[model samples]
Target: MTELDRLASDFGNAETAIALTGAGISAPSGIPTFRGDDGVWKRFDEGQFTYGRFRSDPAGFWADRLELHREMFGGEFEPNAAHDALAALARDGHLDAILTQNTDGLHRDAAFVGDDSPADGITDAADATILELHGNARRVRCTDCGNRTEAEPIFDRAADGERPPTCDCGGVYKPDVVLFGEQLPGAVIQRARSLARESDVFLAIGSSLAVEPAASLPRLAASSGATVGIVNLESTPCDGVADVVCREDVTEVLPRLRDLAASG
Candidate 1:
């Protein structure tokens, strides 16, 4: 059988199948991946995104954040074929959950959660099964009050010369992303690890599998006897160990996977 056919068969038979995505999945939607020649990381100072720097200079943090917004989140970006295919898989019950490292919020925007989901008929509590390893960029949270809100208004204010927006509770509002030097949320990590352990099929897409802890999930699934598949434009360290490796653009491969899943 072809690699895609094998993946389709495994997915069709698996009790629990999950996908892990990174910035590469969103690249087709016009989002730049980190470390690319024209990536946001190259445009800004690395230290500016660290939690320590933000704590020391809140105003400066917002200033840099404004630039970041312009570079990354300012444009109109929509979910590409890759995201739509995954959503379809989830809706059809061929996929159980999506564990993503992307902060872009495209997965959520693709209507991963809603009353319109086909999975709602399968289970009463059916909701978008998403585990965001990194927090969403479209949201802002008060550091002290824990109030979360849409990030556009704050970005607008910042663009209008508001150095740093403040919350009604007098707390500083920061983008709800896991910045450098900040620990990933413990609860989210635990959930991801649990999913990895329980998954019968794991698909790692558009990620280099370079980031720590998050990268380990695929390995965990593999070790637990899950069929591990990876799809990326570039080679990853796990390619040698992955049960299936497809070095193709996610936008192209995922739709085919979705089609194969639908055929069966």
Candidate 2:
């Protein structure tokens, strides 16, 4: 049997299968990876995104953030083949959960891949099934009142010289994402770790598997007796430890795996 066949077998037979995705999965959807050659960091100053800067100069930080957001989500973006595959796998009960490091919301958007309306098995962001390791970009949170709301209006407020948009409670609004110097939400990370330990077949897709805490998940799954699969165009730190390593375009590989798993 081929490596993909083995992966399909495991996916089909396992009681709990999870997919851990990173920026690579979103690259095909026109969202550039931060470390890639045409990455956002290469053009923009990463220093402007730290939690320190947001607190020190909210106006300057918001201005820079608006520019950065445009650079990332400036165009008409849609979920690609890989995202559709994961969503399909989840819909068909082949994948129990998707733990994504991407804040792009592609996985959540996959629910509307074809139709404009929500699909049958939509994975709501508020649900634990689709865990966003980093916070969602579609939201903005009040720094003082902690009110979470849609980002467009907040971004518009910032654009109209609110600098850092102020909440009704007299608090500043910030993108609900984890900044460079900000810690990820404690409860979210704890739940992610728990999922990693509980998985039966873990697929590490499109991630370099280098970032801490997240990078440790594939290894944790492997050591916990789950079969680990890594699929990426480039070699990752965890490639050596992965039970199956496939160097293929994520957009192609995942859909094929989805088909195989469904058939089996």
Candidate 3:
């Protein structure tokens, strides 16, 4: 049997299955990976993205943030086939949840969480079964008061020269995403670890598996006796340890995997 056939059989037999995705999964949807050749890193200084930097120069931080907001959310980007496949698997009970490292908000869009209206030609996954390792860029949070709200309005304010928008409590509003050098949310990390430990099959999709803490999930699942699968265009650190490795386009592979899992 083929590798995909084996994956399908294993998926069919799995009692619990989970997927971990990264920027590569969203790249097909026109979201640029931050570390790629033409990525955001080229234009923006990485040192300025830290929480410390934001604290030191709030106005400057917001100045950069406004530019980033325009770059990331200014265009109409949508989830691709890979997102739909994962959503389909979840809808069909073949997958449990998706754990993602992307801050792009494409997964939520694919899952249809925010709107009564859908994007043109995009189908909503039946449920929003996704866990974000990095926080969503589409949402904003008050650094002091902890109030969370949609990011669009805040972006508009930023565009209108409200560099750093103030919350009702007069606290600074920042994107909900975890900044560089900031600790990942404790509860989110714990839940992700718990899911990895409990999974019967762990699919690592599009991630290079280089980032710490979140990158350790695949190893955690493998150590716990789960079948580990890695799917990426390039080699990942975990490829040697993965039971199944498919170096192919995520958009193509995910749909095939979904079909096989459903058929099996």
Candidate 4:
């Protein structure tokens, strides 16, 4: 049998199947991966958006960040096949939890039917089935009061010449995303650890697996007796330990896995 078929068979029978997704999953949606040939860093300076820069020039940083946001999220960056497949897997009960390192809201947007969803009979997710490791870009947080709002309004204000959008409490609004030199949310990380430890099957999809803590998850699952699978375009540090490895396209891989699992 093909590796994907075997993965599907295992996933179909597994009680708790979880996946950790990375930038590669979003690449097909026209969002650039953080590394590799056409990475964002290659076009923009990573130093310009660091915590240090944000602290030194909040106004300029916000303006620059608004531009950066336009550059990143400007397009019709809809969820691609890989995303829909994961959502379908979760919807069909073949997948349990998803731990995504992407700040893009595609997973949540695709999986959960919100007020904007057009699909019929798809209810909202009652639990935290998808955990964001690096926070979401679609939200804005107040620096002073810590209240968050949708980023669109703040971006609108910024576009209308408000250099840094301020909250009602007179606090500056920052993109809710975790910038460089920022720590991942502690509460989310804790839950992710528990999920990894409890999973019967763990799939590491499209991640470089070089980043710390996140890179440790697949290993954590394996150590806890979960079968670990990895699907990525390039080889990662965890490739040596993964029970199943696929270097094919995620768009093709995830959908086939979903279909096969459902049929099984």
Candidate 3 global TM-score: 0.93
Give the number of the best model, judged by lDDT.
2
Q: Work out the TM-score per prediction.
A: 0.94, 0.93, 0.93, 0.93
Between prediction 3 and prediction 4, the one with superior TM-score is 3
- Rate residue 20 of model 2 by lDDT: 92
Local error of candidate 2 at residue 12 (angstroms): 0.4
For model 4, what is the alpha-carbon lDDT of residue 18? 92
- Candidate 4 lDDT over 131-229, as tens digits, reads 778877888888898887778778989999987889999988888878888776677788789989999999999899999778999999999998899
Tens digits of lDDT, candidate 3, 111-175? 66663222111223455357777888887888888877878999899888997888999999988
Candidate 4 residue spans exceeding 4 A from truth: 113-128
RMSD of 4: 3.9
Worst 10 residues of 1 by lDDT: 115-124
Q: Which residues of candidate 3, in runs, are more than 4 Å off?
A: 115-128
